[model samples]
Target chain A: MAELIFTEDPEDPRLDDFRDLSTADRRPDRPGGRGLVIAEGTVVVERMLASRYPVRALLGVERRVRDLDLSGVDAPAYVTSAETMASVVGFHLNRGVLAVADRPAPPVVSEIIAGAQVLAVLEGVGDHENLGSIFRNASALGVDGVLLGPGCSDPLYRRSVRVSMGHVLRVPFAPLDGWPEGLNLLRESGFTVAALTPRPGSVPLRGLREKVGERVALMLGAEGPGLTAEAITAADLAVRIEMVAGVDSLNVATAAAVAFHEVAATR
Target chain B: MAELIFTEDPEDPRLDDFRDLSTADRRPDRPGGRGLVIAEGTVVVERMLASRYPVRALLGVERRVRDLDLSGVDAPAYVTSAETMASVVGFHLNRGVLAVADRPAPPVVSEIIAGAQVLAVLEGVGDHENLGSIFRNASALGVDGVLLGPGCSDPLYRRSVRVSMGHVLRVPFAPLDGWPEGLNLLRESGFTVAALTPRPGSVPLRGLREKVGERVALMLGAEGPGLTAEAITAADLAVRIEMVAGVDSLNVATAAAVAFHEVAATR
Candidate 1:
């Protein structure tokens, strides 16, 4: 069972993992970055506890800690006053509870691809919120896995985790090592690599389900600057959502959902 | 042509519509509310200019104003320094331009229904960003109009306008007056009134396109408390996006896109 330790001091050294969280939990390669996987609120904390990531500790008000089913949790949970919790975290988190976990090594890219019927391949989706939303959409739509290409942000980023409603913790993701050339690997594995773009000559997403064979990979890019030319060329075919002329393309995550519904939902 | 007038003072009475914007332009029914339509940044401001709403004035840096093709604009465009604009708006204006328009009387709900092949009917979707995203998706996926039901926030609120990328100015929407009973009006007008919910006995969205006949109205509610029992019962049929079991439902906007792409994209 998880250990419940009551503490009143805000500056305790044992609580360092929970201090100044806005900066402390940034990408580990950056300065002052511990790279801890931080989960906020009851739902996300529960998700972190269930994920493969190792739990380091938890910080929350007494009531919040008590509400959680900590019988299976092995880490120490520090219960403190809300005011002290806010002071230590450098922000007033109304969610009232937080969990920090150590990120395990990411799964091999090929392994994620091997087990998937449908995959969402992302390029240049650097916005944290968009990255998170993609995961949430991927999970709901039955996309088996996500493959992050170059320029994609970390799905485990705090903002991404919050925006994804903690689905980022649930979905399996791995970084594809090669760039546009890596797309060839999908074709060799009997997957149809379909790049999503608005450029002329792209097939309308309608009826696309019938055209692609069994396995499908929906490749998408950032919103404004869509999939690069080389990426499109590497794909077996290009697909696009029919839209009103002169209107901007749909947000990448929204576009992914539409594509997922069309090609991946049934599989 | 828009008259470009230079202004140096931050407290000019002419700028009152843009003052303390975070609170000033709330729904007119609220206390201290003027309920003016506000558009931020060059793109949204340009959309406001082309919209039916009467443009009151514009406050922007000189360079941004110069970049706009203001050949037919009738309003006076006020050119101001960023510092003065910040003081007037109560925050930094990073988008570099702003436009305020008077809210014209909304179109009758019947007119929007009469014209649209596909319509999105919303209930209790009060979050501005989600509301804005729904509009953006509706426009891109060929949803003809939107019918607002009870508990919905004003889509013309500043944040919704910004997040919609000004698509809110283009898409026609009107309030549905008679609650669940008002849904009967849609059935009379040839809309299927398919309520989107995950409850048991709901049809899978996968082939819903074939079952709904010609016109379709996708009724959606807020993210957490989805369509009410009364609302779902009023619909001709309950439909749901096929989702992975044990996963949370898709965000209302994302779900709307999936439905729109299925039923409306072709039409």
Candidate 2:
């Protein structure tokens, strides 16, 4: 079990990781501008504790702190009043409990590909909420891993962590060094790289199962601009979710869920 | 052409319809706690103009107001500086424009069902953003209309109108009276009512086309506690999106999209 510490001081030095959290993740000197993983609320905090990321410490009100199963946890659990907790965190967090963790080494790209049956290759998914939602969807739909191409935001960002419901910690992801050219690594690994787009030449997402290999990579881009020409050309084929006339496409994360379900489920 | 009225005063009575917008949609005596339809930004404003709602007026910055095609609009478009727009609307609207319309009479449920092949029936979807997103997805995926069961919020709420990218104005919806009992209306009309759930007994959403009728009415509950037992029992059949073990179910709106694709797409 973890040691419990009681503190009422908002300025306590031990609570530095929990301070002024609104902008704490953007410290320029920190690696990735986000050295610590923050899990808010009980459900997410539990996920962070169970992840490969090393738990640093926890800060929460007494009632919430006492409920956590901190057995085998080496970190201190600090119990503070809600008022003092708010003062340190720079805002009132309705979730009541928060846990912080140190970033673990990301999984190797080749290793993730070798063990995965389905993967999502994302480019330019810069929105934090969308990125998190994609991870949440990926986890629920059984996507094996995610590959981040250029222009994607960090999945470990605080906003992404919270929005993904801590699934960002569970799903393995790594930044692919080269842009569209790097896709060759997957093709060589026996993965069919299929770009998701709405071009007329593309086939509908339905019946995609019959057209792909054992391992599939669904490539997606940001909502408005969609996948670039080079990315789409690198893939084996382009697929689209059939949409009605004059309507904008689904949000990137929502579209990813539909595609993930298609590729994961057996008809 | 619509009249353009320029004003520098934030207290101008002509902008009354757009004042204190954060709480403007919650008039107690108003039907459904929403009396006016508010469209924010150029895209949503354009949709509202083209919708069945009767335009009352428009408030926008000079650049955004002048750019609109107001040739046949019967209402006044109030032009103001950005600062004045913010002061009047109680917040900074990056969208730079706003339009208000009187609530139009909702379409009759029977009429909507008569012309629809695919429909969404929602229950306990009180969150404005989720309600808005569901409408947006329904519009994009060719779901003809939405039927609101109990516990659902008004889709025309300002936030819903904005989050939906104005699709809420275009997709017709009407309250479904008599709770689950009212579901008989769709069944009587030759529609298969499928409740979306993650229950063990539910059939997989994939290949659902083989089990349902020509017209499909999908019944969805809110995120956490899905359809109530009563609602599920009322449906002709219950269906589930196949999910990986231990992960939470998909968001109510995302789940709706995947199911919509299955019913609307040609595999």
Candidate 3:
């Protein structure tokens, strides 16, 4: 069971990891200066404990700490008043609990794709909330894993973790190093890389299921700019979700869910 | 063509329709104390001009106003400095433009369902962002209309309009007055009202296409407490998007997109 230490000082050095979290994006403790994998609220903290990331410590109000099932938790859980906790964190967090975890080395791209039926390959998805929503959608819709292409944000960022409702901790993701050129690896491994774009001549997403075989990789780019010419050209085929004329395309995460349901849900 | 009137004062009476938008939710000019339909950004503002809602006025930076094709717009366009616009709206709006419109009487529920082949029936989806996202997804995925059941929020809320990318104005929606019992109206109109739930014995969303006929009304509830037992029991059939066990359910809007792609996109 985790040890519950009572702390009243807002400036305690023991609570350094929990300080000024509003600016946590630039924490030096994280990989490449991106913040630690911080999980807020009981549900996400519990998810972090279950994940491969190594948990360091926890800070929470008494009621929130008491509500957690810490039988398997090994970290020191600090119990503090909400006011003290808020002062320490630099803002009032309605979730009341937070856990920070060390970033584990990501799996190799091949490892994530091995034996997987479906995968989501994202490029230029730089928004943390969108990245988090994609992870949540990927997990719920049965996408086997996610591959980060060029310009993708870290899914372990604090905001991403919170937005994903902890699903980011559960989903496996790895970086695909070679950008558009790296897509050939999926092709070599028997996966059809389908780029989602609105360009004419692309197949509608609804008809895609009938054409693809055992393995499929759905490549998506950020909204507005969409997939680059090089990325779209490198894919095995291009597909689009038919939409009303003049309307903006659906948000990236929502589009991914539609594709995941059509391509991965039952597989 | 719309006339552009320059305004330097933040308190100009002509700009009242666009003032204090953060608290605009309770504007007296709106029907029943709800705010007017507000569209932010050039795209959304253009959509508002094209919508059935009667435009009251527009406030925008000179560059943004000049970019709009206001050939058919008859409302006064108030061009102002970003600082003045910020002072009036109570915050800095990066979108650079705003348009407000009076809420027209909603079309009868029967009117929205009359010619629609696919529709969305919502219950307890009170989150403004979620409601907006659902509208955006509904427009993108070809869901023809939306019917709000009990516990649903106003889709015309400012946040909803912005998050939806103004698609809420494009999608027709009306309240289904009699709650779960009112769902029979869709049945009478030759539609299969399929409730989306995770209950056992529910048909998988993938196979649902084969089971349902031409017309389908997808019934969805909010995220946590999904469709009540009564709501699920009232449907012609219950269906679920297949998901990994022990993972959280997809966000209500994302799930709706998945279901919409499965049942409505092709139709």
Candidate 4:
């Protein structure tokens, strides 16, 4: 069971990890940045406990702390009054519970490509919410893993974790070392890397499964100004979600979900 | 041409529709509700100008006002400095432009159903962003119209309009009356009312296109606690997006996009 430590002091040093969360948990790679993975609310907290990330600590109200099934949770869980907790954290958090975990080593890119039947390759997906939604979609739709290309935000950022419903922790993701050339790794591994672009000469999203085999590394870019020209050229082929004339392109995350469904669905 | 009357004062009664927009555009039916349809940013403003809603006035910086193709716009375009715009809006309106339009009489639900080939019937999807995203997806994926069932937020809400990239202005939506009984109107209109749920015995969404004909009314509920049991029971058949075990359900908007694409795809 996780150790339950009750604290009333707002200035307690032990509660430092949960402090000033709004901006503090933003850039995990920056200086003075505590690179801890933070999970908020009970649903996400439970998912954190179940993830591969090592649990560091937990802070929550008495009821919330007690409500969690903390069996084998080695870390300390601090139970505090909401007011004291708010004073420590710099703002009121209505989620009632929070958990912080140390990020595990990133999975190897080659390994993700090796084991994946269907993979989502993302480039320029810097928006935390969009990145998180992609992870959630990847998880639910049976995408084996995600390969993070350049300009992708850190998936372990607190907001991304929350927005992903903690699926960011569950989905295996690794940064692809090279740029457009890095896409060759999937091709070499018997994966058909198809870039999702709206450019002319690209194939429509439908009937893509008929063209490609079982292994697919589906590449997606940010919402506006989709995949760079070089990235599109590097992929095996370009695919697009056909839409009506004059409508704005789908949001990147929603587009990812639609494409992921098409890739995962049994036709 | 839109009359670009420059204003220095923030207290101009002409800007009332644009004031305190964070709360003003909410609950258009409530007491003290101005009930004006508001669109933020230049893209949505242009969409509003081309929509059925009557453009009442515009509040924007000079560059943004000049950038719009305002030919034939009968409404007054109030040009103002950023400082004055911020003061009048009760916040820093970063989008550089804002347009408010008087909502025309809502299209009849039967009329939307009659003209529709594919429609989305939303129940308990009260989140403004999600509702807007659904509209955007519906427009792009060729879902002809939207039927707002119980617990749905107003698609004309300012946040929905902005999130929808002004597509809400383009796609027709109408309120579905009489709860579950209202669903019969769709069935009578030759729309196969398919309730999207995760319940057992539900047909998977993968091959849904093979079964359903041209017209489909895809019903979706909010994120958690999906469609009410009564709503599911009332539909012609239940459909589910198959997922990996133990994963959370897809976001309401994301799921709608997946389903819409399936319905719209040329197989």
lDDT of each: 0.89, 0.92, 0.91, 0.89
Per-model DockQ? 0.87, 0.76, 0.81, 0.75
Location of the lowest summed lDDT over 10 successive residues in candidate 2 chain A: A26-35
Predicted complex 3: CAPRI docking category:
high
Model 1: lDDT of residue B196: 94
Q: Please, what are the lDDT tens digits per residue for candidate 1 over residues B1-267?
A: 999999989989888888898896555674446478999998898888888889989889999989888898898899999999999999998999999888887899889988988899999999999999999888888899999999999899888999999989989999999999999888998989999999999999888888977899999999999999999999999998889888888988888888888888868
The digit string of per-residue lDDT tens for model 3 on A1-267 reads 899999999989999988899898796655587777789999999999888889999999999999998899889999999999999999999999999988889887888888588999999999999999999989887888899999999888888998999998888999998988988889888999999999999999986889998999999999889899999999999999987776788899989988888898878
> Which digits, one per residue and each the tens of the lDDT, describe model 1 over residues A1-267?
999999989999889888887886465674445378889999889888888889999999999999999998999999999999999999999999999988788888888889889999999999999999999999888898899889999888888998888888888998887898887778888999999999999999888889989999999999899999988998999998998887889999999999998998867
lDDT-best of 3 and 4: 3
Cα deviation of B138, candidate 3, in Å = 1.0
Candidate 2 deviant stretches above 4 angstroms: B28-33
Calculate model 4's interface RMSD in Å. 1.4
TM-score of each: 0.97, 0.98, 0.97, 0.96
lDDT (0-100) at residue A261 of candidate 4? 87
- Considering DockQ, where higher is better, how would the candidates rank from best to worst? 1, 3, 2, 4
Task: Tally clashes: model 1.
Answer: 0
Candidate number of the best DockQ: 1
**Candidate 4 backbone collisions, by pair:** none
lDDT, candidate 2, A1-267, per-residue tens: 889999999999999999988987776677756658899999999989889989999999999988999997999999999999999999999899999998888999999999899999999999999999999999999999999998899999899999999999998999997988899999999989999999989999998988888899999999999999999999999999999989999999999999999996542
List, residue by residue over B1-267, the lDDT tens digit for candidate 4.
888899988999988888887788665565446468888999899999999889989989999999999998998999999999999988998889999888788898888888888899999999999999999998898988998889998898888888899999999998889999999888887879999999999999878888988788999999998999999999999999999889989999999999999986442
